[model samples]
Target: MNRVILIGHLARDPEMRYTPNGTAVTTFTLAVNRPKTKEGVEQQPDWINCVVWQKTAENCANFLRKGSKALVEGRIQTRSFDDKEGNKRYVTEVVGENVHFLSPKNQGNLFDEPFSPRPPVNINDDDLPF
Candidate 1:
């Protein structure tokens, strides 16, 4: 079983795209920080690539933005392909099965709206522009 669960901050807004068959897909990099290192210096953030499909992808693209914190559950997959320079490249990505919105900014907003499965009408994709 290949499984992965990550809780991290978005390094950038999710890049949303559609498959040839009109399946929605979104990709984003997460910056995961290590708690503490033996050296006591901050360890470099780990950049994990994650992809979500269908409604999950749409939700991610609609709500997620750079610096947003989220929890993702998925499986790890590594694929090898040739680069433009003809060099073999091994790319590792998480095929996300679940994405949970954990944005801090949304907490205790002026309206005091509670978190919902779907964001409010006012918080639709157009408002986010992510």
Candidate 2:
């Protein structure tokens, strides 16, 4: 019941860092456009903060970039900490369980070649049952 799924473009490139214990973590902001309720109404974009850990965090940092589209499935987490000013600051972010890269493999800057469409395979007449 705490699950959340979001498909959106990266607001910026993912930032990777290591914890004090040397655990890898990555953070990124996703910009999802909301649906318009009426004709002529413009959709607003929601900026969601997302986090990934370990190998997933490394992959996200390596493959994803600004404007890259992805589907993130995760759970919401909120935590609070005291700032240097002694004020309590709270943050809410999605802790990603899985992130599906939605952009074409070739379209990513990580890849060298551009995407080329493959020709359709011809079906044999004997293969059809109907």
Candidate 3:
């Protein structure tokens, strides 16, 4: 019920850090454009917070940069904590499980080679019949 899928451009390079327990974590914002216009004017872009952990986190930090288009699949997470000023702050983020490179057309490729999307895997469950 918490799943989320997003395809957008990165607003900036990921901010990567390691937890005290030594787990790598990366956070970034994705700019998703609205498909529709408002009153004949373009709508403002939507910025979504995304996070990745461990190997995924490292890969994100290494390969992704500002303005890079991305496809991400993850689950929604929200947490709250008290800041130094004692004000409670709440943030929502997508914890990434899958990431696909989608660099922008205007900037050109960072890597010369093209990458393809993964092929779908056929599923045959015993509960389902043809």
Candidate 4:
């Protein structure tokens, strides 16, 4: 199966564009953290290239920004093309079938009220199932 699932923060703002046929496409780089090395040194995050299409592309472009967290479900696709230098280049990227916005609702809002803790709920000891 050519399936891939990634959860990461966007390294930069999503770039949206349209194909000649007017199909929407969005591209972004995801910075996914890698596990520490055996020596316990933190490794640099892996930068993954991702692509989304259609309405999902539009939504990703609208809601996701640099540093926004997201979950992308897709498949790994690799393609080759001739570059301007006349050299063939190969690129591998995730073609997102679904992109879920994982950032807080008011994450990038500047005018939103400061967050306040909710009042603690009072429950009787009898409510415990344990």
Query: Which prediction has the highest TM-score against the true structure?
Result: 2
Off by over 4 Å in 4: 109-130
Per-model lDDT = 0.87, 0.92, 0.87, 0.91
**Number of the predicted model whose lDDT against the real structure is largest:** 2
Going through the candidates in order, what is the number of backbone clashes in each? Answer: 0, 0, 0, 0
Quote each prediction's TM-score: 0.76, 0.81, 0.77, 0.80
Instruction: List model 4 lDDT by residue over 7-120, tens digit each.
Output: 999999999999999999999999999999999999999999999999999988888899998989999999999999999999999999998788776876223334766578
Candidate 3: which pairs clash? none
Evaluate model 2: give its TM-score.
Answer: 0.81
2 versus 4: better lDDT goes to: 2
What does the lDDT come to for candidate 4?
Answer: 0.91
RMSD to true structure for each model, in Å: 8.3, 7.9, 10.3, 9.1
lDDT of 2 by residue, 90-114 (tens): 9999999999888866658454335
Deviation in Å, model 1, residue 33 alpha carbon: 0.9
Ranking by TM-score: 2, 4, 3, 1
Which candidate, 3 or 4, has the higher lDDT? 4
lDDT of 3 by residue, 1-130 (tens): 8898999999998899999999999999999987776567778899999999999899889888888889999999999999999999999888899988877444543443457565798877965785
- Superposed Cα deviation of residue 105, candidate 1 (Å): 5.0
